[model samples]
Target: MIPSLRLLYWRPSAAALVRTRALLPMAEFYNHETGDGAFRLIQKSDYARALQGARVGLCLSDHEGPMRASVEYQLLDLPVVTTEAQGGRIEMMDPAHCRVVPADPRAVADAVQELAAEEIPAGAVRASVLSRLAAHRAALPGLIRPHLQAAFDDASAGVTLDDIGKVDLWRTRDAEVIRREVDAMPV
Candidate 1:
């Protein structure tokens, strides 16, 4: 049997929908448009509360980019068990912060079990999330300017959300990103 990951997938395409429906018994299907997946899908109004209520935030995004959900999870201090494809942003998180693992079921299961058993300090986790969010927000304007200019100069080079694919939450030394961020801040 698979471990409880409390999957929170958004509206997927028809092809993806068919595949998931066939594989699993549709524990909960959500469509904010028609309010189709309310309890099963969950109410859009309560989406935030729902995310906060969960024990863990599971993101298997293969084409992820600066995942906001991941940050929210960190803010909530819920342990994460995501794929490496999500990338290095999570490197700052300690082993205790969350369990960044492979996307596979077995690996996810292991991470989930470990996090569930561990004692996580929600306050500290939330602080980390807030700090990271601020740093990322500050850097975003500069980092994205070039990409935007490139897109404007050449329509073919537009940086669409789809272009940012799955990332690896663990890349370089986690502390380095934070330290560099601190250094970059103007006194």
Candidate 2:
């Protein structure tokens, strides 16, 4: 697919938004029809469809595990611009095609533009990402080391597996704080 759009950034958070805004002049993504000029919120159902015209994948999350969207972008032959992230997403990237950047907005924006403009071969992107991802997949088990599973196992020694699964795995800090941060950015 031709990269008609400049950037694709799927995971959004308050800190992510601060950086995302710097690249807004170039990216094209859709969310919940926020009626804002800088963005349109995307739905999970149409994520792959939304990635079609994107020139580069912007992954700036501070998530502690492997990011799914960054892998998806590479598989689709799109170059990536990622931060010095907590997760091992960087390991899946070949520096020749994808960039490992700092959290700074200006730096991320510059790297995204550079990758977007380059005419790197699609096959090369996919090949490199695949090789790295394969190697990382093998190495991952050693690094994570039964982290959450071990905790759950210890906590539920006599409890059923099904019982352990039911829990408040996800929650937010404060809705108003998030809304305020989002409002701070220009539409």
Candidate 3:
């Protein structure tokens, strides 16, 4: 745990650990090392609660469809620093609330610092995201209506995994044995 929480660098999915790891140095620099500049990878839903005391958010993805995590930050009115995304995610970001920076520790750290200092209103950022989502939400019925019956009536196929393939691959290391090392964790 960071002694003082200033930034919340969220890994949108468990597989996205690398992106956050590369930038841990930035978290360390800003959080001043008592136990902070944190990263989250739990398969849990209380993500918003983790942002209770954070000042800025970091969402730097190389490719994403809509990048909901970045928008979540906006919904909470937390300023964000992000890299250019490949899947039209930037279209939903608020230009005044977010800074499109490179995926560098120094640049991101500076952006975090700059964003934290600015007095941006919560409503403005939230409105920016909502307004953009309006179009997608409005079109949702039309898109789903045609498939609604099939979606509800079709018999869904069960998941099939190759016996040799890894299970829980999202949170495992290569060739690592699966063990519950509860004793290794901090109290």
Q: How does each model score on lDDT?
A: 0.60, 0.67, 0.60
By TM-score, how accurate is candidate 2?
0.55
- Residue 73 C-alpha lDDT in model 1: 73
Clashing pairs in 3: 1-35, 2-35, 2-36
Better of 1 and 2 by lDDT: 2
Model 3 clash number = 3
lDDT of 1 by residue, 71-151 (tens): 667766777777776454565454556776766878887777777777776587777767766776565545645534544
lDDT (10s digit) by residue, model 2, range 1-187: 2234444444467677667657554444455233364456455546677677777887887765778778888988889888888876887888888888888877887898899889897588889888886776665444333433454555533443334346531122366754675467443
TM-score ranking, best first: 1, 2, 3
Q: Show where candidate 2 strays beyond 4 Å.
A: 1-29, 34-45, 138-187
For every model shown, what is its TM-score relative to the native structure?
0.60, 0.55, 0.54
The number of residue pairs in model 2 that clash at the backbone is 7
- Model 1: which ten-residue window has the lowest total lDDT? 164-173
Model 3 misplacement above 4 A: 1-45, 139-187
Clashes of each: 11, 7, 3
